[model samples]
Target: MDFRPVLHILMRIVLITAVSLLMCVPVALIYHEPVSPFLYTSLIATILAACAYGGRGKQELTTFKRREAYLSVTLSWLIVSLIGALPYLFSGAIPGITDAFFESVSGFTTTGSSILTDIESLPKSVLFWRSMTHWVGGLGIIVLVVIIMPSLNIGSYNLFTLESSFQEKIHPKIRSVGRRLLYIYLSLTFIETFFLLLGGMNLFESLCHSFGTVATGGFSPKNTSIGDYSPYIQYVITIFMLLAGTNFVVHYYAVKGQFRKIKQNEELRFYYKVTFVAGIAITAILFFQTDRSLETAFRESFFQVASIITCTGFATADYLLWPSVGWVIIFFLMFFGGSTGSTAGGIKMARHLVALKNVKHHFRILNAPNAIIPLRINSKPVSAQDNNGILTFILWYFMLFLGGSLLMAWLGSDVPTSLSSVATAMGGIGPGLGSVGPASNFAHLSDSSKYVLCGMMLLGRLEIYTMVMLFNPWFWKN
Candidate 1:
């Protein structure tokens, strides 16, 4: 391991985080929240960054190799989450060190799981930091650092790929692609905030919810989430969640007047089609079986379906109390996440599409002994390497999910609670069924179980392989 490159990256992350906190401090003060500790935390971060980076060693920064890229991505997230926890700890809102770390991880991972029973009682500044973590985390910490500091442009592309979900390379130049992504991200957040404010939400609430929506983090300002808000506000959030879960590369293409490319993207078409069909099915079930009006049922069904399908986890109503089939529908949807290159996490839709195509091809080859078939997506034949990687990733993902569920069950959780918690945590979806359902928080879990779920969340957020590679002995070999 090259200590200099690792130290250099860590210093840069600390400096970036400190600056981010300083920018947020004024916002906290305006809301009458205490800023003294936040100020001190920022100072500490800056000083630490300086100490780490200001060495007189005659070492040039090494170009990050693939292994270095994996290490840097993992270390950056772990270190930044530790630093990000400072505000929560210093602010006294989440005094326990474990809880603070958990909140920070949840925020930065865009997992949206909260241990706090009362989210509304937290101060505005702390809340801002909470939502800010989601925003920063949504695009990815390493990607954000790469865009802001162009000096690291060359080595950072590998780190970006390691941090990002989609295996698809969108652009030849990483910097240009990063800039376009940031632009699209900012525009979506701004538009969503405006719509929320127009729909009767206050400025602060609108901004916070907008951060959550665009990030697809689902950290609602209100304790009841979107349920306490106007129908218009709920619908606005629903629309943005759908948008947020889409591939940003497609959005970039759309912005650049490539309408045909946008329309022909197979993943986007499949994503919307699944969402529409699921929405109709769930809405019909809720309307016919429950005591809700057709409009009310459709609204609730659409919101919940979108939330779970995108892995956003925002709740306007408790779908756990719905019929048995409704619960099963949600459970299945948890596995099919948003598109690749989007903020939402899980096994991405593109990977599933590839896997399904390969499955069909396998059967066809079984029947025709002399036939040669190629798996294709978006009219291009899938490479053998890409197909192998996707298949391996999916297999390992399920194995880990099953292992996590069994561990949780052994730690005193029921079967459904264990299953959903495992799925939700591994999928980066916040709420689960039974006790860890949409309406309930994860406060009731045993401390060990919470830690387990936290690990699962990190694994899910980092796209499994990134975290799993750290455990491989070959990763550390010199």
Candidate 2:
């Protein structure tokens, strides 16, 4: 694999992260917090970017191939997470290396799991930079899906990428698609910020929340997450989280006034079906079992459902304290993720839909001795390669969940904490069950456990195979 293009892009990514760091400077100045943390981190990122560029490949980035693409994506997230930790370290917000990396990985993966027990105690600038990690990571996920992953063929995502309509709606060039998605992403953030402002949130909190909402990242600047906010604010966030969880392609079609295409999206349909069913079920649970009003029950249920389904991880209420059935509903939804081609993580609805179709096909085959059946999604027949890829991905997802849970338990966490923490980490959803639930942070977990969860976050956010490929011996072989 040619290292030049990958080197070149990594340099640019580091520079982009450096600029993101500098973005916190203004916030620091405005809030009268020390700016050294961001400035110093930005300086370090600049030097690393320079070093990466120093080894520039003469070939253009477009020349990078499959192996390089895999290396590039894996290294991009890992390196950014590595550099992202500098802020926490410099600011002394999180002082330990393991904890800092854990927080950084959580941020860059947009996992929203945090070790910070008192979020309100951090400086506004550090919090802004923290939220910026989500915005950047979210952008990274969007770019990878729209412009890169389609070509990589991971998880048989070609189902979405192979569609000709997508090419017509968005430009074919990588840079063009990235720019277009950036506009859509920024628009969502700004629009949500405006709405939150209208709901009486301050500009700082609004931007932070907007960053989290649009990214589907749940790292709020508040200790209570979204629980302290008004219903109007929660409702707006719930709606946007739903939007964020849907495939960005659907949003692109909606932007192009192509509502017909959006409506025809099978994965979007599946996503909505899961979300509403889960939401209504939780709403009923909350309403009958508690003293909350119908509207409050509806708001909290939908918000929590959207949060978990989308992997947004925000909380308007702690469902762990609710009826057992309420939290149980959430537990299952962790495995049923949002649409693919979106920043939201988990196994993804695209794979789940395919898995379902494949299962139904098998039942039919069981009734017929010899039958040729094709698995289909979005009215297009799925290739056998894609079928195997999707199912294998699902199987591996569960296997890793089991392995990580056991590892966590072995590391001394109780069964509930171990299972849900691993599940939530792998799902990129914050607030797991047990000790890591919405009301608690991961601070209590051992350093070994935090590191394990960090690894889970990367594998989950990258859709597993991308990162796991690096561990395979042949990937490094000539």
**TM-scores for all predictions:** 0.92, 0.97
CA shift at 231, candidate 2, in angstroms? 0.5
Regions of model 1 farther than 4 Å from truth: 55-62, 141-172
Give the per-residue lDDT of model 2 (tens digit) for 1-478.
Answer: 6788888889989999999999999999998999999999899999999998888858676676878888889899999999999989999999999999998999989899999989999999999989999999999999887767776566677676436656554434767777778899999999999999999999999999988988888899999999998888989999999989878877777787988777668888888988989889988988999999999899989999999999999997788889999999899999987888888999898888887887899899899859887777777788887788888989999999999999999999999999999999999998899999999999999999999999999999998989898889987885
- Candidate 2: list runs displaced more than 4 Å: 165-172, 367-371
Spell out the clash pairs found in candidate 1.
none
Once model 1 is optimally superposed onto the true structure by TM-score, how far is the C-alpha of residue 358 displaced, in angstroms?
1.9
- How far is 147's C-alpha from truth in model 1 (Å)? 9.8
Per model, how many backbone clashes are there?
A: 0, 0
- Candidate 1 per-residue lDDT, tens place, 115-208, comes to 8899999998888888888888887732633332233232222222222332234334565667778899999999998888788888888888
Output the worst ten-in-a-row residue range by lDDT, candidate 2.
Answer: 162-171
TM-score attained by model 1 = 0.92
